[model samples]
Target: MLHKLNLEHILFLDIETVPEYKDFDSLSDELKYLWADKTKYQRKEDFTPEEFYERAGIWAEFGKIVCISVGFFSFKGEERSFRTKSFFGEEKEVLIEFKNLIESHFNTPYHLLCAHNGKEFDFPYIARRMIIHGISLPQKLNLFGKKPWEIPHLDTLDLWKFGDYKHFTSLKLLTHILGIPSPKDDIDGSQVREVYYEEQDIDRIIIYCEKDTVAVAQILLRLRQEELLSDDEVISV
Candidate 1:
């Protein structure tokens, strides 16, 4: 079945996010209280809600996207190449650029958006962020009435699960098992907040995001039992 997928029709993407504010103390009184309430159960008795705020980037309500990198496969005869690009900077600007790319280039119903755990994390986070910024959702990301099979988003984690509801696979682990180079060698999601707030380097984040996007495509190729892409075959735009 994997052989039937057209690699050119899919756009593999990954996003980097950080808490909306540099620190929990920066939140408004009302929002701080709300956050505290929302995380009470998850934080438990050991750690206070404020102490858990470092993980706010995983939540759409408390975080904002810093970078969104996307890659697509291109073919000329039997040669395959992966072209990648990233949208970075302010949240609204990043979302706008991403929206334009999806709306203009991959607007067709046949086009798919793929990422590792995208259905749970990347996909909904992008959609919610777009809504918060008053940006219209692109056709592929919007899921107002789409049936299960109709959703165009593909998730590597979901594919690996293969209907095993309790199984959870990280992108790093999957890449290791498939023998693809690890995207998290330099920095992982745990340090994104520190990199964004302390280092204040958007270029570094973009590079990391692009690696993840490429890794997602590589995972897809592995699933299809195809040769992995070499470093020279990937181009950044």
Candidate 2:
């Protein structure tokens, strides 16, 4: 199925999010109550809401995207190259930039957006964030009444599952098993919140996000039984 689709029609992406506030105290009393309530099941008396705040970035309502990195394949005759770009800084700006890219360039029925675990995470997270900011949803992200086949989205993680609904695979683990370069060499998702809030290193997070995006693309190539992308074939622009 992957071989039937044009590689250039897929925009591969990953996002980095941090808690909406740097600390639990930054939240208003109402939000504090809401946070505690929202995470009740996940926390399960193991940790207080304050202590578990670092993981708040996993929830769209409690987090803001700091960076959204996207990569696309370009072909030149017999040669192919992958180019990546990132939108970072204010959450609204990052989202708006991404929306424009989708609406302007990849806004076609044939174009697809792919990511690892994206169907469950990246895709919905971006849509929710955009809605919160009053940004109109791009056609690709708006899934209101679209049937399953009508959605212009692809998920490598879903492909890897292959009907084994109980199976879950991390991008890093999948890449390793597939013999692709590890995208988590520098920092994993668990450390992203600290990097963004404490280290104030948006650049580092952007690189990590782009690496995941590239890894997602590479995973697809591997699934299609194609050669892995050489370092020279990947360009950050």
Best by TM-score: 2
The 10 consecutive residues of candidate 2 with the worst lDDT sum are: 193-202
Clash count of each predicted structure: 0, 0
Error of 1 at 178 (Å): 1.1
Tens-digit lDDT track for model 1 on 164-233? 9799989999999999999998999999999999999888888899999999999998988889999999
RMSD of each: 0.8, 0.6
Candidate 2, 1-237: lDDT as tens digits: 789999999999999888999999999999999999999999998999999998999999999999999999999999999999999989999999999999899998899999999999999999999999999999999999999999999999999999898999999899999999999999999999889889988889998999999999999999999999999999999
Give the top-scoring candidate (lDDT). Answer: 2
Candidate 1 total steric clashes: 0
TM-score for all predictions? 0.98, 0.99
Local error of candidate 1 at residue 206 (angstroms): 1.0
